[model samples]
Target: MISSNKLIAAISLAVVGGFVAEFAKPQMPEGSNPGYMTLISAAVGLCVGWRIMGPRAGRDSSIGLGMLGVVSLVFWGLAVFGTIEMLRLAMRRRFDEPVEALEMIVTIALKYGQYLAATPVYITLAVGIVISGYVTNFAYRRWG
Candidate 1:
């Protein structure tokens, strides 16, 4: 079993790595495909999670690592788009008329709707991580 200090270091490194990827995103060429970035980020996240979390003594943890990567992607994707949209809305200073207000509101709603369309992936990643963590912990205590 890995020591607690080592585990914490791994997790910290992973989180920092994840954030680095996230922050470097905008510096990447605009118009580049975001899907590709997402995949790369997920891969990085997985590596970090796995490195930190480690595999149980004799069990494969590859699947769990992959799930963690996916979870990171989903969580980050939502956060990125949500924050951008909110910033855009916040930056807006005026709506010309009732109709304009309605239009702006509708536009914002539509953007949010599209953004939230990926909810299943997010939910799956979230539930998978929680369940996997619990199972890993349980297995470690019971079987290790």
Candidate 2:
């Protein structure tokens, strides 16, 4: 029994993340839309938090779910954008120079981490992340 308000906030944040992705236009081909990745990531994160925490019927659980949903947004943003950028780098062979297969893999791993650590990932979710936190904080304080 997920809280309706929390669900709505989660969904809205996903949508906001999508808009960010669409505008960011990092590695996507011209006219390509990468928004769906953010959408899917947010949905998956919500599901994951719901599944692990179980029904949100209980007061404690509802609060937990609310907080989890907010945190999940961060994870989703990082993972979805990071993977997309990493894959783009790999596909374009954007490394400084050609390398052995094993080296390529290692370099990709490192770059992936760097992408995750980059500012744009957080920027994409900037306002939305704050909104999520406020939503959850409200949920916990008001109802949970």
* Top model number, lDDT: 2
Candidate 1 structure quality by residue, lDDT tens digits, 1-144: 454422432443344434444444554456844444444444454554455444531243535643554445445444544454455555684655656554565565444335333544345445545544554444455555
Q: Which runs in model 2 stand beyond 4 Å of their true positions?
A: 27-35, 48-71, 74-121
- Per-residue C-alpha lDDT of model 2 across residues 2-96, encoded as one tens digit per residue: 66445545555555545554444564446755556655655655554444322332344434554555456545555555555656676787766
**TM-scores of the candidates in the order shown:** 0.31, 0.44
How big is the RMSD of model 1? 10.0
Cα deviation of 115, candidate 1, in Å? 5.3
Which 10 residues in a row give candidate 1 its minimum summed lDDT? Answer: 4-13
Error of 1 at 86 (Å): 0.8
The per-prediction tally of clashing pairs is 0, 0
